[model samples]
Target: MLSVRSKAVASALVVFAATPVSFASAGGFGDLGLGNTDWQVGGFVFVAPKYEGAKEYEVRGAPFIAPTGLDNGTSRVQFRGPDDLRFRVLEFSGFEAGPLVGWRFDRDDNDAARLRGLGDVDGGVVAGGYVAYRGGPVTPFVSYHHQVSGDDTGGLIRFGAEARAPLASGIFVLATLGASYADDEYMDAYFSVTPGQSAASVAGLAVYDAEAGIKDVYFGLTTDVPLSDVWTLKLSGRYSRLVGDASDSPIVEDENQFFGGLGLSYRFNID
Candidate 1:
């Protein structure tokens, strides 16, 4: 027989051990799966900069719902974040692969007061797929998405790993590290500045045509604390560094960006 605290610790370990790790990329949720076949609902408040390089920060709220379990024959539906919604179409032998679709917010000059003349990047729907393998305490995954409708017509590819380790009573820590690659169209849309555009903007701003390459590398840490049988609290922090063409873009003010958030979730099991 296990005590309440012991049970809580065991449950936390199972959840982290069974799920795929995700990094904080556009339209990405760090940890998600049908593990334990339980439904979860939660909301979070986070502080993030307006754009990759901007100095201003904005506090925003997001809601999430995971409505499927990780049973062998069960399907999964999840809303991981504002820009990440996915459905698992296939599941077998510890492997889950599915279609992912989501919306991306436009980056307007107004997003950051200092970007008034940099122009706006239109938001649109992205469609893609993700394949993940969960074995023991290590999960490795890959995902790709293309801008199906928007001003940007490129795609993105991401690969990452997630690992978990128990710390103390009912507490666990999860860490994620990943890298992202962007296509030429996507890179140019966000990082490029045309000669005409440069002339219309501040001095020393050069016309740059960004080519496709590794855009950023990111890492994140999440602390999970089980409060009760059905409730859990999570605290997370992430840092991303712009690299290659993205880092060289004159419009970019800060090459590194940070984000932090906290959330509480409730789980409901359906039998």
Candidate 2:
């Protein structure tokens, strides 16, 4: 086990080097000098919502990096996804825990005509932590996020379970299902329509107060096909259905949002 001081120093270093993927882009990798870590790096092209809750879509590209622990007793595997960067600082049994940081792209009225009066929410960093347990074929995880900079969109709590399995020779599928909960500030910043906003709305939107609650449920799937021993074809898609007040907001053109993209990446090893 690393001393508490040592762990904090290492975590801060990772926080400095890696930037979160944000609402528009997705993913990254590991810890430095952390023993024999199997590293994976690749580039990805993905289409995502230009802003959360917007019906519009845009094509985007991001890099991918994931690192796993060797099956050695001294290490444990870490996980990465399209929106956040996390590095395991503690592992015991099949459980690993770590600090997490993700980027949140802001919302601007120009994002969509429907947002003509909602104004702009600044984009900034979010800092949080996560815990996960891996066993059998499924891994369950939970994480919390709080805006550390930019507009005070407050905090979000997200929980989910993911599974990976082989679909065919040299091909595999990974899937994740999750839901998000938001604090009052987070719910209101993008969902609430203030009197001033209502008056300014070109669409004549009504004023609505979006309270803190369960905001949305989401699912994501990834299919990986090996093109060669060192290269792979990665296809991914995610769908999210806004619920609660987030769905009812006058600014929400569509309560359901989708994203899909495919990319080629070189693998470092068997994950």
Candidate 1 has an lDDT of 0.64
Model 1 residue 27 CA deviation (Å) reads 26
Please provide, for model 2 over 179-271, each residue's C-alpha lDDT reduced to its tens digit, 9 standing for 90 to 100: 999999998898898999999997889999999999999998766666787666767777999999999988788888886767665546443
Candidate 1, residues 55-101, lDDT tens digits: the string is 66666555555542222222354333233445666667888788887
**Which RMSD values do the candidates have, in order?**
10.1, 9.5
